[model samples]
Target: MTARHAGYIVTLAEDIREDDADHIMTALRMVSGVISVQPVTANLDMAIARQQVHGEVRGKVLQLLKELQ
Candidate 1:
């Protein structure tokens, strides 16, 4: 018998600089138990960088919650 757990996906509203993202990831990883922050695609038209922040945090989305709050 085995058990599997579902993960979370967080999307940041603002286009975050790579350095800032790295800092946030470090802070959250300590408690949030994150798996990884995936590719960030910059949209020239919208001037927004979309990134995939995946993990198993029980509460709010890490990237967006951190940046928004």
Candidate 2:
């Protein structure tokens, strides 16, 4: 049977430096079977960020369609 695990929150031995977090997350995402990695923090609103990105992409596609018409 496949594991029903959703995800995990990895904590570093010491607080990750702002400059190093990107490198660390990138390395974790390179591991086999890893889907995605994001930094967890109180101030970061991932949902809103994802929605904004989706909206931007959608707008761009609509603009391209209009240009093609």
Candidate 3:
């Protein structure tokens, strides 16, 4: 099947620890549409969504990270 792609620039919550970020990355990778997750900084993450899924994936990832705040 052909898949759409979306780029995400996520900002991590200030209180989230390195371990938690690792966990979050793991979880994000498990999501259906996620292609890759990269940690840009303690406070920033970048992800690629392989299946855009009507544009919900990007917003979902953003919300998930923001929820950590």
- Could you say which candidate leads in lDDT? 2
Q: TM-scores, in order shown?
A: 0.41, 0.46, 0.42
lDDT of each: 0.60, 0.79, 0.68
Clashes of each: 0, 0, 0
**Following a full C-alpha superposition, what root-mean-square deviation does model 3 have from the true structure?**
13.6
Lowest-sum lDDT 10-residue window in model 1? 49-58
Assess candidate 2 and give its TM-score to the true structure. Answer: 0.46
Residue ranges of candidate 1 with Cα displaced over 4 Å: 1-5, 44-69
TM-score of 3: 0.42
Which residue pairs come into collision in candidate 3? none
Cα shift from native, residue 22, model 2 (Å): 2.2
Better candidate by lDDT, 2 or 3:
2
Which residues of candidate 2, in runs, are more than 4 Å off?
1-3, 42-69
| Tens digit of per-residue lDDT, candidate 3, span 1-69 | 998658677765444666767788898899887898987643223233323453687799889999998
Best by TM-score: 2
Among residues 3 or more apart in sequence or in different chains, the pairs in candidate 1 whose N, CA or C atoms overlap within 3 Å are none
